[model samples]
Target chain A: MKPHPLAGALLIAGTVPIKDFPLLLGKAEREGDFLLVDGQRIPCTQGTAAMVTAAVAALDYLNLDPPMALLAGDVGEGRGSRAIYDFLSRELREFSPKVLSLHYLLPIITPMKKVISAVQGCNPRPVLIADAGSMYAAKAAGLATEFDVFTPDAGEMAFLADSEATHPAYIKRYLFEADSKEVPRLIGQAYGCGNAAQTLLVKGVVDYIARNGEILETVREPDVPQMEAIGGTGDTITGLVSAFLQAGLEPHEAAIIAAKANRMAGKYANPTPATRITEIIARFPEAFKDHLCEWSGVCTVESRLRPATGGARQGGEA
Target chain B: MGLFKDKSSSRGRGLTLFKEVKEALKAEKILKVSGYEVKLAAPPPSLRKGCDLAIEVDLMGQAGVERVLRQNGVEFDRIVSIDTEELEPLRVVKVTDFGDSMMVRAGNMKVAFEKATGIILNVSGGGCPDVPYLHLELLNKKITEAPRPCELGFTLCALMLDRALDEGVRIYEEARG
Candidate 1:
């Protein structure tokens, strides 16, 4: 089977690599004072998407056709590292992506339009697990509609469904405040590239995928003790969905694979709580292949997988 | 950029930390299954999710792991080792530790994490783009509501190596009994 040039979402996440104080990720978890990766010394700032983008962009410039990127950044010593977020938004826009995806975000929400414009797309949409602060901005920006989605856990869903916030200051305060605890009846909340893109995906026993006002697929993974608190699990899912977008699978389809893959990967790596993100991404093609083969009703290549291709190093003649 | 910082932490013991496990287990004789990447990890309270990342070794007695890495010429500016719990990366350990349990833990963690990812390749599934896979136990049984209404799934997948192995024993006992 010939592999499509565009596979699911081409994930792009970059992060800062400085004293990753609160969280020591992957190999970073090993060294208490210094940061290590793939068994070598690396600066701690390497954790954020901001720093990671240089490599991703280099890969892209190398003609890597990954459409979605998860620009990640770990906060350094500061009250709020908006600099990292703003820097990512700026640097990422230079890539001129068609659509922007958000996982854990916290820059100015209104400036999303400038981003969509720079990306040069007709209708830009963002996929996120909507948080209390982002919901109103989405609505007011005319992007909070059914086209957008929110992947939150039960608690988040219940919170969003009831038009509530976990805490008044759980996150930093913003202009749009709701008093009644009900999803406020705001004015002129239309769905645009930016408005409705912010969504909340509440991670839980039964995963519920929803958008503006309707529920999408509710994919269920096998129950495992590890699912309870894996950081970047949802981020990985988001990245997976983004990566598959290149293959032309619907967002939901990509999401299904990502969700399942993450779960399965979790199962495979059980007990080792600190699994690196890049390590798992390396297996995407095979996992995709197996999933298709297992679920194929009647097929040869199987409906789940088309030929897997990573181009250049993996197989394609770079 | 304000993603991983939290001041409230006492910088406590990372119970499920696998880096230490890898350091402890390096140099252990192990198997790196064919057509799969190696995963490494450390000891934990329980076998939930594991491995630092797998080093190449042959599942049929260590042929597969080395062959693949060599074949792929996997590049690394460095292959650093670290304490599994604190993530305090240790001075680079020799890559020769395929016979140690700690090494096995590190490599296994990598493999397990990598393997668990991705979607069903079938167009019926992967076509959904970024859909995430709902986790299915590799060896343990788990119940879930299927995509269809009232549809239930009993998966005996997610497993601990010992439990998964014990399951085989239990199956034999039941048949014999």
Candidate 2:
């Protein structure tokens, strides 16, 4: 697929512990195990840092501009989450992004509603993707349908399938028992209950991409069993798919390619149970170089050599 | 006395309701151990049902608290901000008794054990990759002696398995006593 003119901000929003309330915005860079953004170092071992680092790496590999990150230091406290919500409510119009990926924020309904309202007010509405805490909040607030994509693991799928489940832990016993084999059923149940996004990238042993309760595609290749044990592999897939969506790939296509690339990246990393998510992410550039052409029907790998324009903080040092 | 004083002074307080008082107690222990500032509190009159107990938590860290609770397999009905509208907690576990054995289920995980010996007969359910590994670790062990599922595995399945195991042990102890 030929890349479109990179338009608007490719934005990632989440929380990490570095301070209390101030929202930090800048191009994200991975330095060692930490994600450095605007002089603030966020650990990449888990949560939003891992997701944003993988996304920044993928965009960088594609020679696209790195993502602009909106981060706060929220160590499970509400202050940083409130800060992020306040910023989005007050500044999202001015900081309109083309694609906004939400991760690891406290799942409070009022703030999430405010943030959604701010996002909806953007001149050109952003493609909204949610995972982890954001996804849970969206579902809890009955706003999952507002998102373009939700990247959920099997456990999360169970939560979505049970219309009454406000959180994964509280899903009905029968639904939880359904497991991965019940993903297709759960997808249908989620859509039936109006608790599903426009597109569901259900990540599991076999990644399933579904739209409107209909299965679009499945990618189970390049099997990397060790990837399951590694924390943040799901987050990395969410990051890659977010970048692909921002880069103008269709939602289903982005989901498919990202699933394959994540597995391939794992293969390239030759990961073990002890492997960190960053190691798999470090292989994204090589994995993309080897497969982007074939996957997207992009004419040549040479095209990737040319730097893309219009990315957030283009040409700025991290 | 000062330190033990109900630290429920945070402006943004939330309550986690469970189906049983035992569930609430278990969740409180898990949350405290996980570094959350939480306390067991009586559910408001409007919220009381099967369980009179509820866990009070700082609303600000609700997401983190919920994640930890879920990770450790502490099943709760719903976490509601104290200021929000009352929502009822759902009872998700079911205990079924057979002549020789009993099964306790929480979410997708089930623990069945011989009644006389409390030896685990089967551990099943959950779709996470860790389920099979956890199943192996818990099978054939006495409910009280089996390792906690959350300690041995890292998945929602493991958490649910832990929930089942916890319930199973409680039932066995109650029967014996």
Candidate 3:
């Protein structure tokens, strides 16, 4: 098989907008203190912190060499981001990636009033990027456009796809509602053909890549069940796509491979009972490029890891 | 005051297993008891269901604890037992297998810090990051700085429980639901 060109030097990143209301269970109650998970009992505050830690923990699962590359979204105080960053520095000395780059747009944090640099202070990774609303955060930190490439989804595309912009003449923010046939034409002529090396990879039923404002390529995710509705699906997709890039696949190839793998993973989940998003995430790796793809009539169960330390892992650091 | 001493089995309404009552004892040590199994029940106006009572033995299995209860003419259905192998919050919460995931309800509990903004959260868990991650996804969105409490995870949860309560935030039933 021909190795996908345009591999490595790849950075993957995405953002998670935690739900505003805590998914608390019951009425609020006072004991001595603490607004609990149930409002009546457990203490489970700090939602964004949970996700950031999750990302940090996810890094532990990486099959890295050294200076393991880390890529995750950022907010001011870098509160959660800072923890992951620090964790990488302190604990994980064994298998670090040669470089680290974030694949996410920065977001503003309140109270700070100043735009927080979500991806600041990361070592060895030469680029710090901003997209959409995070653009303001990046610029505030004086690191806007430091990146070799900037990637965004459709919603972000509209924000940057203005005709006034130099590269992609038009970014299709409304791609969802836009007629399908017209999409290729608009993306190709207006978005993909632009002079900007900066790319926007919009995730949808069909993943589209627009670079320098030109439509680079499109790969439809084959047989991806309705997994998008369950939150964090996009984050996982972005992670995989970036992983392919970091693993030496071209941006476009990364998109295709990630889309296929995500679909296959979801397809794997469709039949199983108690299919937790967590379970699918854990079943990754061996399910992806690892185990041989066995096409049993029932479902393709990927080859699992040779029995080792313990057993198949429940994946991710987060 | 003299709960857990009654060993005499009184067969009556709301009969719960020894395991169930043991869990209730673990939950609210000073629970009011009634009927068979001595299940924990809150006073009226706080009718949270599933409040059964068992021997109110101190957390550590005292040497004469079981004997005292047996000696004292305490009426109960059966002696509840808990393996304690998987007791999550051993210091605060213990589960006696009640034939199912032990269900606990907080009674006479007041809404501690509901509409209060600007609180701090601290998360702790086993070396595994499942609960901490879930806690973060669920809690950290609302508060500030619920960082990893410690290097040793078990202690982190203990600290988290204590800190949240000290700050006037009422802790409630863990949101396993």
* Candidate number achieving the greatest TM-score relative to the actual structure: 2
Candidate 2 structure quality by residue, lDDT tens digits, B84-155:
332322236666665677777675456678889998766543333244345556666888999887665533
State the displacement of the C-alpha of residue A310, model 3, in Å, after optimal TM-score superposition: 25
Candidate 2: where are CA atoms >4 Å away? A1-7, A18-22, A300-309, A312-318, B1-177
Q: For each predicted model, how many residue pairs clash, with residues at least 3 apart or on different chains?
A: 192, 4, 67
- Give candidate 3's chain B TM-score: 0.21
Q: Using Cα atoms with residue i matched to residue i, what is each candidate's TM-score against the true structure? A: 0.41, 0.68, 0.37
Q: Over the stretch B54-159, how does candidate 3's per-residue lDDT look in tens digits?
A: 3432211121232233344433333222322211111222111112111111110000122234232222111111223333433323323333222111112222
> For each candidate, C-alpha RMSD in Å?
20.5, 10.1, 23.1
TM-score per model (chain B): 0.16, 0.51, 0.21
Model 3, span A9-97: residue lDDT tens: 32222222231222221212223223222322322122222222222222323332111223222221123333333333442232222
lDDT of 2 by residue, A92-142 (tens): 876668889988666566678889999989867888999877787788778
Clashing residue pairs found in predicted model 2: A1-A296, A1-A298, A78-B60, A177-B108
The TM-score obtained by chain A of candidate 3 when compared with the true chain A: 0.49
